[model samples]
Target: MAEKRTDRALDRTELIKQTTLELAQELGFTKLSIEAVAARAGVGKHTIYRRWPSKGALFLDALLPADAQALDIPNTGDIEADLRTQTYAAVDLLGRPPFGPLYQALLGEAQHDPSVAAALNERFIGPQAQRVRARLKLAQRQGQVAPELDLDLAFAILSGPLYFQFLIAQEIVTHGYIDRVFSALFAGMRPSP
Candidate 1:
C-alpha cells in the first residue's frame, strides 16, 4: 500500500538522523561527513541530500529535539523558582556531552555561514528567546516583575551572562554562579516596594 512506503521512508529518515548523531558523538561535527552518514545509515547519499541541503542542516535536524516542549519554561507561580528551574535545565543541556560539543561546533560554523546562522536562529535560539520573553511577560502579569520592564532586555540579561561564562570566559556554569546571577538579576527586575 502507499502508506507502507510512507512508513518506510519515515523509518529511514529516523535511522539517518540517529546515525548522524552517533557519528557526531564519536567524531564531532568537524570530522563527520555525509558519506560516512550514508554508509552508517545504510542509505544512499542521495537520501540525505533529499532530506537536507548540507551537513549543518542535517546535524541541526539531528541535534534539536522534535518536541517543542523540550524547551518549555515552566510556570510555578513563583517566577524566580520557575525561571531558575528552566535556566538550570538549559545550562545542564548545554553542558551535556555529544550535544554540548556538537552544538558549540554548529555555533562556530554559523559565524562564517549566514545560512547556518539563520537556520540555527529560526529553529532554536529565536524560539528560546521568545519563550523567555513570554515567561517574563507572565511574571509581569503576576506582579513578580516590574510592569514597565523591557522584556527583551530582561531576556538578554538572563541569558547573556550564562553564555558569556560558558563560551567566552571559559568558566564552569556552577550552581553557585547561577544562584548569584539570579539574585542580582531579580533584585534589579522585581517590582519596587
Candidate 2:
C-alpha cells in the first residue's frame, strides 16, 4: 500500500511536469500560470508550489532537458567529429516544438527580469558554458586545436551562429544547417599545419 502511494506520487509529479510543458508550449511560458498548470495537471496549486517555489522555478524545471546536453560533451578523439555530434544534438533539441520557442521566450524574459536571468545563468547556462570550455581544453590537449587558441572565441565561433539563427534570424535549425555551421566555423578554427 505504501509502495502504491509512492508510485502514485511519482505519477502525479510527472503529470504536473508534462502538463506544465504542454501548456507552456501552447500558452507561452510567460503566459503560463501555476493555477493553469495545476488545473491542467488536475492537482491543487499547492502541489506545484510544494515542488517549485515560483513560476521561474517551475519553468526552469521544464527547461532542464533542453539544456541537459550542455553538461554531456562527447570525447571521440576527434574534436571536429565531437563538435558535429554535439551540434547535431543541439539542432534536434532546438527543432523540437516546445524547446525552440520556449528558449526564445526565456531569452526575451531574461533581458529584463533579474530572477529569470539569474536562474538561466546559474542553473542553465553556467554549467554548460563550463562544460564547453572544458571540451575546448580537451581539444587543446589532443592537438586538435591550437595551443594558442582562445577558448572563448572558439566557443563563440562554434555556438554564436546557431544562437543567431535561432534568436535573431528566427530561421530553421536543421541538421544540414548544423553541418554547415560545423564545416564553415571549424574549417577556419582547425589547427594550422
Model 2, residue 187: distance off in Å is 3.9
lDDT comparing candidate 1 with the true structure: 0.88
Choose the strongest candidate by TM-score: 1
lDDT, candidate 1, at 29? 84
Give the root-mean-square deviation of each candidate in angstroms.
1.6, 3.0
> Model 2, range 96-177, lDDT digits (tens) per residue?
8778788787788677777778888887677767777898899888888778888888777877888899999999888888
Model 2 TM-score, all chains together:
0.80
Q: Candidate 1, residues 52-145: lDDT per residue as tens digits?
A: 8998888888887556455777888989988899888888888878767787888887887788899889888898899889888999999999
Cα deviation at 5, candidate 1, in Å, is 1.3
